[model samples]
Target: MSELHHYLELNDPVAMVWRKGNSQDPFTDRNDLLPVINGIITLLEIPSSQHKVHIDGMVEINQELYNQTSALLPEQFLVNYANGSIQFHPQHEGATFSCKYKGKGLILYPASRIYAMVRRHPDVVKTLQEIIDEAHTKLNDTHLAMDQVEQAIREAHDASAKASMAADWASQAAANATDAAHNASHAVDSTKLLFKPAVSDMKELLRTHLNPQVGWTVQTYKDGIRYRYDGKDWVPIDIFGKNIQLVNEHTDGLMSSSEHSKLKSIPLETKERVIVFCLPSYLFQGVQNIVARFPFKGEIVGIKAICGVPGDTDSEIIIEKSMNMKDWHNIMSRPVQLDAFSHYDDGQAVVDRATVYAGDCFRLHVVKQGLNIQNVTVEMIIKI
Candidate 1:
């Protein structure tokens, strides 16, 4: 029988050859290139040479070397298999070969396949590292921004609190200034009352001529009149009831006379024209009658009186003043019947009286008895 030649390819670009004869002598050239055949053939057994002499090479693949070389290649050359195994194609200058390996199997794969599969691991690891680094940087920036926002919030709160406190302090200061201004205004008004030019002169005159006790100072001065009193002066402090003339130094001698007799007798006249100043109608309860007499003689030709009523209604009173004891002059007379005492209800009526006189030593009378009297005020004005 003749012999046959066979070839086997290996992953390292090497081929192995062997010779085979009939079945009775299968490996006829077993000693020829047996080692080289083992380096290429992946199977252990030879092919059948029953009727023909077959020469085939047994390829022995060095799985370790294939894996080491394949690991050096890039992942682009490696393919993923459906069975959880990897297949790699090794392309060298114009030649290419593919080899497959199971993940759990001990079978060796081609060096190119192993190199391509292993090379992808490093790229994946590097990509994952880059992703992780980017994530870390982004997280750090976010944290920094959050810190800045928190700081800004704290500062804003502090500034708002300070502004609120400042506003409160300013409000308090304004209120204090307003209160101080009010108090100062009141003090100025009081000082003006104490140093009024006319009232001060009148006080000095009273102090010199009247022999009044000390502490009899004027407290209120208005409308050409002064209200004065000592600590113990309780005689009502009325200028009219005292009967002494503040100008002519004469007393009203008819003050003790009965109303009927005074009504019938002619009152003494004043030579110098006298002026009687009273408070406003609202403050008329504090009004005082001041009599100033003069020396002269003339006929009683005129009689006039002024009466003031505050917030008067139709039911108010009208009183008459008389120059001659027999004749009455209607100063505030009305046709309708009026309440003669309406002024007493509000305490807001003032009566000022003057008479054209015919003689010196004028007499004046101002009387009030339980807010009612025959005459509230009587004054005589005489010619000079």
Candidate 2:
């Protein structure tokens, strides 16, 4: 068995001895002679613009007094990284400063007379010290200002981050609102399908369920008329109905189709199966029952229709007919014979026998009048 060497985190050996029966280790040791490294010497700070005192001396600054003043370095003398010698020109009129020359070495200060002026005029040291102290204070203030700038930058960065987070939250809120609106729309559609009125026989269904006591005439609609109903009284439905702001100040579209409010419409045709009818333009709401008319070629065996009010305001649907389109009579009205055909929340449906003479076309009228309510939807299912 043999032992292995183990090293510490600092890679220093805890113990050293002969290995593998060797007489001595393969390393030699000797005393390490190191020079004393003194603390860094700081130089006095002064501007070169006017402080530089050129003293062509014959000697150098005394090692004991060199680089011993603490002050802020000038803008030109400040270094980024690595260390280098920077000249500090202090404010002084005399050439008491000295430096080493190329070949001559020791260059005496004051050229010849003041080779060591500071050494002789020792009182000058006190005055120079005072000047250096003032410079040190200025430099310290500059450092403090730089530190404050860094702190302001950090604070601004934090504020910007918070604003970004707030924006993200606002975006999330908008997305949630959109989802809720979409779900509410879907629920409304489901409710409509659940409560939709369904009927197969038009004539019998109307005679048994509608105002058979009143005159009932089939109001023919143009092709492609859409069917719709309101959940509450037409009062609430008025707000939902697509309306054109009528500036009653001016008379418009008295008899023109273009000026009248447009309505959703469908085609009126003779078909073997049940078909839907539609009309163009707004509903006829007045004593006039002439809102829309349809003229089909063939004969119709069965006819069913659905109609209702669009506002909570009271109104009536009068389906009047005239063989000559001049004198007309009603076949069906809402609220029995006591009132005309109408509905505020519920749909008013009717079925009746309607036959068109081969030579004479049938003329149907939709007369309505009252309030601001003017439009309603009607779906027709006719069997040929």
Candidate 3:
């Protein structure tokens, strides 16, 4: 008979039992038997409230009872089952255990090691769907944000184009306005020159107004002299005598001279009004030439002239007005031939002279004329 003792190793998940004669040495050098120990612990049944079991010193059991208990052992722990007998041998020094199977080897492992041998399983569809859904949502948000950004850029480009066009139009409009203003100013200047009088009018006035038959002669008065014209008609003395001095003094004098010499002397104090005439038929249409001069400002009113040649079918009358005295533009008239003395009265159809400011200057343009012909003479009547 033998006594048995049981111990469990918590860190190794193994249980061991020893059987010895009374006073036998304690078991040792049996660590390699841990797997076999765990297998035995799994095969035995322990009695307790929560399946706890303990090993106590026991002498022996009946042979029949030991054999039945041995039958309950796991397959790896049974040896010589067909013989209906069990034998134990010590494999390590001071160990009281033997291999349960004599020729075959069995190794037991911890529960954790068994679990490690199993493969892991996961829900593939669930994970893939979550990933896909998140991607779809992010893509949709990105597309929307990109659309907003593009729209803003388009709006900004449109606004810039509109502003550029407006600026171009404004610049063009300013240029046109400037050109129109310049043209208007030129038109006004042309009108002014057409009405100015020249130096020739003063000489003509002196010739017409002063006569010898009238008293107050230029030969009798040099500086200042009074002359008797009639009973109560004694005129006062002046530079341009009452009437006769003007005819005598200006008739033979040099108009361009700056000094008063005997041959070119003129009364320095007196001024006279000049008159001239222009006939549209003989002057403007017949000889095709007209030129006159005046002293100050005046207007052309009428023309009177005598004809030298007989009236012909080609004769015509054309009156042209001009802002510049050199270039005449058309005003009014009809076609006629002159064979005798004739008159052309323009009436209110006149070109009036304008006053010039001190520092300002003006110019006139003869834009167009009534008739186009070769030769003509125009006698103009001007009032100053």
Q: Please count the clashing residue pairs in each candidate, in the order shown.
A: 19, 41, 28
Residue-by-residue lDDT tens digits, candidate 2, 74-93: 21122111121223333222
Rank order by TM-score, top first?
2, 3, 1
lDDT of 1 by residue, 1-384 (tens): 333332346433322233334355334222111221211222132322231111211111234655677542422232222222222233322322222121211122333332222255355333443555678999999999999999999999999999799799999999999999999976654343222223433546455536544334342222233444433451223232333333222333323235445555765753455433332222111112232333343433233333344123222332343344434443322211213444333333333433334422332222221222122222223345
Clashes of 2: 41
Q: Higher TM-score: candidate 2 or 3?
A: 2
Window of ten residues with lowest summed lDDT in model 2: 99-108
Please give the CA lDDT of all the candidate structures.
Answer: 0.36, 0.35, 0.36
Ranking by lDDT: 1, 3, 2
Clashes of 1: 19
lDDT of 3 by residue, 178-292 (tens): 9999999766543332111111333342454354233322212332343323223334333433443333433533232233344455455443332333333212212223344
Relative to the unseen true structure, what is the C-alpha lDDT of residue 262 in candidate 1, on a scale of 0 to 100?
51
The lDDT of model 2 is: 0.35
